[model samples]
Target chain A: MYRDPSDVNRVASLGAGPIGGGWTAHFLARGYDVNAYIHDPAERDALMAVVETGWVSLTGLGLALGASMDRLTVTSDLAEAVEGVGFIQESGPERLEIKQALYKRLGEIVPADVVIGSSTSGLTMTEIAAECETPGRCVIGHPFNPPYLLPLVEIIGGKQTDKAAVDWAAAFYEVAGKAPLVMKKEVPGFVATRLQEALWREALHMVANGEATPEDIDIALKNGPAPRMAVQGQCMAFHVACGEGGMATNLDQFGPALKWPWTRLEAPELTKELRDQMVDGCNAMAGDRHFRDMAAERDRKIVAVLKAVRDG
Target chain B: MYRDPSDVNRVASLGAGPIGGGWTAHFLARGYDVNAYIHDPAERDALMAVVETGWVSLTGLGLALGASMDRLTVTSDLAEAVEGVGFIQESGPERLEIKQALYKRLGEIVPADVVIGSSTSGLTMTEIAAECETPGRCVIGHPFNPPYLLPLVEIIGGKQTDKAAVDWAAAFYEVAGKAPLVMKKEVPGFVATRLQEALWREALHMVANGEATPEDIDIALKNGPAPRMAVQGQCMAFHVACGEGGMATNLDQFGPALKWPWTRLEAPELTKELRDQMVDGCNAMAGDRHFRDMAAERDRKIVAVLKAVRDG
Candidate 1:
């Protein structure tokens, strides 16, 4: 049987690119001994440079007990890197064939009980693990860029992935100080990327239409919605914005505006079913907190964020 | 000639709803003597309540010299509110007819040189200023909710508006502590709202499709891109993420992802013209700073913001 995630103290970081190096730095800071694998030995200096840069920010965020850069080891041999590591993170190039072949090798080398999490932002794990003999252990543990600073880690499983593997990965990432979102269904771009792409495409359209410059769009966002969003996401922010009435009042007031030609993307029809889902979801998110209290908390956090950005 | 925006110390804030009341509190905190007009006498207390709520945040952000809530004066009579004010901000109901009639009365009551800035989120300046005789001085000064905290104020002008009016509104908003984006062309939702709506609609689709819940989406955003966005907007953030190569490297690496079916919105074709526009815009935004320096600055600011949010 695979050791519990909390009992696994060593990790294998496969790939020497930005994402892999970031994972190496983060794991080391969390007091884990890391084995980092690279295809080209000449890229060793570049990977270490990435780790050195990441270490500054990690130190600022604080290090775990016994955390040290010396705990990391680099190797060019694939089998050597996977030896005795409880967890394996694969962040190779985005090409499907490259990832499939790598996963096939990883499945043969690593213990069957160990979980292998791919960090591919584009390719789904189902496709990447197609050649793997032990596909049930392969899952997606994607992170945003500069993974050392950002806390999000999206956990998704392939069609052949076992539920136990997904749960194990989630628990491991939590212990590693990550905010994990274990997806229930596979979709293109998952959640955050889809939302980000939507916003980014609209920004490009505005520039194409000569409505605003890129700088104008960025300034508007950083100064307007971004700070508040850092405190609370869009749904909860609007829920709090409506004050005591919460999201129900927000829907009544702004639902019609959703039909306006505000964006190029077409909105889903606000069906009764969809409306209830939204209201219920927001209520679940709010739990017992009153709208007034949430709004106040949001305002307080936004003030702090604004000050931080300004002072920095 | 109208008094210079820097010399405008007294302003009229018409309407008493959330937007108007937010403007009232902001102006008062900036040390401007504000005359607020409401249609209903019963709303006076409610208006003050909004101001009181805003005052807590405004004070936390630091009050300007000589700033005090006592500088605000409430009146039900529209004429009394406009009397002797140097600038006017109209935040009445969203109906075009109501706004047109209000603008007509505002044009007749205030001097032609005094710029009338509307805070409508939906209606365009051209449509709202249609019935006004002094349309040349009418402009849009739309602010996000809780204008006292968020610094962005998008300034737009109608076809009848003078260039001087747009410039004047931008200057006045800056003097009142706003990061103003003076738009070059009129669009339906302006810059920020279009971007925000695109993201929001996509989020709704995700929830509707049962891919994720509202809480899941919120957790993904708050932990992923939102905090970094608070420090820098998307364009600059991506530019810095590519390291020494800047935006050019970023485009070469990830531009293909734009063609992927990641979002429901159709992206504009990545023509050379658009590419050059984006690259040039980012280069101009970067100015004299090297990519490494900017990345360091971004990391520092993001760290501060994350710490602030976590502590709060």
Candidate 2:
């Protein structure tokens, strides 16, 4: 059953690293009580700042939220955060054991009806669900970063996951004003992450093999195909890009090029040399911004673009 | 040199198919003297009507030019269209031989100074330029369909093509209110079309292979990734989608899946079996709408979304 937005008395974020904090801010902005848990002491202030910045940005975008900033409660204890929560978002480290243990703890305490979701990139739900007593209650509620603005959530289920449980989580995300897509089965990386990884791997391989500059690869996507893709999904964009003859004609024509030597699906392992090359390429491609600052900057830009779309 | 919008006299479209007609309308709507040469007799009235309809749409969107509607001229005579033209756009069939022969004819008559461009999907400038007497002047000026609405033009050059020619075409398209991206080297399908074809081929393969239904595939993109992608380009979208860890972590953790069998690189042959599968799948997905009408309706919706972005 989907929790009514008005009925959500408390919301808990199990991991208050950058992403977890964002989730906390999202619930808080919507007037739901937030219990955010973070393990790293050094990260506490930064994560809190992230939540505040996100709240400020959302308000700046004129998004109406009836909640006050005081609704947020940050804690170091997981059980304290999970108590009386209608929804729990786990944004722990991507490691399987860490997630498994977190789910076990949360599953033991949170009400049986509460929805449990993971911010996992691509790890299997079957594996993650192994930690919970009510395994069926655990679903992959994968959200893109700065969760408040980017409206995407991949809802996937594991072998033991109940259909009702997945549906409940999906419904809750929808009520939270997030665009949620349900995956039929548990797949590694789910869908969006898988497609992205494939593209990223190829892009890196191009740099590793010296086919193109790191900057060119990014520019190739950003200034080139990216604009068209913004409006049309990759497949639909190709349907138009290849003309009305559609996928059949395009496949027939470009199918031979799939075997092109330039497209290196397999590159050398990321040894010290490869790592240096990759880092250099990425640093050159992205310029001088540090990762966190870049990520926050990206989130701000996403908000600006989303606000433009909303206003228009 | 950019074609002066105020000083523009004649605009020629060498092959006026639907895409060509869009370019034709773009020039005419910008108050230039538009001339088109189309092979099919039945296309004349329809093309003219489309141009008129496009003018109305542009005016409604507050992007209209003061050009008279009756100024659009369609003729069977290719020579007549090219005579004294300041700019030329070729949107003929994708057959390389046909394009080569047509370019030869165009080369003989069109003045040396006139900027000529081919809107060929995958055909490279090198191949098209080889047939021209003044090969150095030939360049690929590929535009996204519904050119009057989509502002992108991929300006790519062949080995022998002159840099001045590509720059001129870029400036002209910019003056005509289009964003032109220059490709350093000519590749099949250029940038947008290549990425599009790659994703499309995989999507069709997935449908053919029984992984997902057509409607679900469309839903997965439109409601989920496409909305976010509409704001950020694909690379940046991935940067955001990967959460706090960013592309490096995303690549290392999920990169192995690039070689996974999830994507069918070799699609099933387009036999009667595949045709039936596609027709049935798409028809069931689209429900009651005929394909042509559905395509037109889709275009209209895209125009609305694009106008939101452009005017917003």
Candidate 3:
């Protein structure tokens, strides 16, 4: 049964895994007809369940775009998913070969005008576009996790990605009620991940070195900039830290001290020793809680908090 | 006129100048003795007017720590400000020599254990620490702007810093109801600034190259992970991005792809032309609004948003 197609744009999530499912929820809740494709047939039910729950939450929050599961179609065929879609979000396995094959196939079947984006955190737009026939039409529309809630989508370009393609993807994401930032050029991990990795790497190093407890380190972020960062980006955050002097004043005063010996820039060789330490450290820190449960708790609180912000 | 020092633990901010005054307000409002240091001498009355306005708005929202500005002290003398004070958060000039001279004087007169912390964003802890005779004791308790609202404080280490000094400072901040994360080793820009700089550099590069408009870039952050990050750290944020795959699944799937040349690692040589483009781009994007007003608005919304989340 078809609802108003005019009200619901035809959108497809190229990989119906968890990220793909999130993409599905985001679009479907916004009244888009979602065509979700997943390689593993067994997980289809579970995936759909997640989508349903997402719809419930979105509807409760009044963010639901009046769409329902009746509009969602699950499939394994790439062509079936891509046909007549206005926007396509590919969240397949991150392997270049796998993505290349998938995109090459998608390029052949999907209409040329459709905006195709990859939920890749690592691969450059160039790498993703290399395999596509009309490389300029494909771009990276990397979103933060649980796309239904978070609004950031880093719009990056592959080597051959046309400027128009990036602009188109940004506009599409905006229309989707998503926040989209277009990168000047391709970069690993884009903006957010790279900043995060730097801090994470430092945390890992601290855990490895035994300078402070994991609890202490985590407490630092939870209690501090992580919250402020929710509102202000880093530079502005520091600019504020520097008070009226702005960044230049901050730099001239504090920049030289960074030359000390403590900051180990070289990535720790993730030897078995480092790996074991990480595994042990994280497990010990997390305790008996499953990561999924932890993630859910995180999401629930984030949603609750964001909702509070929205309402206030 | 003696205001009760007992209620003095309740702090009130007089000016919304930079978010520094807001940080001072955070401590005082949270049940600490605060004498807010407003830079403008003539605007003392005007500043108090500003503080009174915020008081009605903020306290009405129940943010005051069981007390209100009835306990606050507004003073011009740096010495009188810290007299009988448990902590002094000096967010004055960002100039190194100026701040150094101020802290040096503060070091000579203020009670030895009063825990002097500057909100210096980029200044090295070593240099700031060097101003005091008891060098190790002085530390940088850098907070993100809008500290009264957000919970991040980058506890940095300087050269000649004693281990206990960092701990003591951390403890003091924690007791003050702030989350203080101690950097294992001193890094330039600390953990947050460095990562933020990396992202900003890339953004500048994009603007210089004419890839995307500033509004589009800012929208990317505002609408996306900037909001999500309020609750979760970056590592976990990415974990969520991988959906239910958790960190392991996510790392496995996306790890290999990270090797791609997606990041503009080579620092953008900020040519004169590039710098001009960046300034112009950002200025046009920001429009005619004063940065301070812009910042105050951001903090107000942030406080509201965070409070909403807290209530939710």
Q: Give the TM-score of candidate 1.
A: 0.96
iRMS of each prediction: 0.9, 13.2, 12.8
Residue pairs with backbone overlap in model 2: A122-A189, A230-B230
Better of 1 and 3 by TM-score: 1
Best by TM-score: 1
Of 1 and 2, the candidate ranking higher by lDDT: 1
Superposition TM-score, candidate 3 onto the true structure: 0.67
Which stretches of candidate 1 lie above 4 Å from their native place?
none
Candidate 3 chain A, poorest ten consecutive residues by summed lDDT: A266-275
Estimate every model's Cα lDDT from 0 to 1: 0.89, 0.61, 0.58
Please tell me what DockQ candidate 1 reaches. Answer: 0.82
Per-residue lDDT of candidate 1, residues B141-236 (tens digit):
999877878999999998899999999999989988999999878787888888888999998898888988888888888988888877879888
Per-model TM-score versus the true fold: 0.96, 0.73, 0.67
> What is each candidate's DockQ, to 2 decimals?
0.82, 0.07, 0.13
- Give the worst 10-residue stretch by lDDT in candidate 1 chain B: B245-254
Better of 2 and 3 by TM-score: 2
Residue B290 of model 1: what lDDT?
A: 92
Rank by DockQ, descending?
Answer: 1, 3, 2
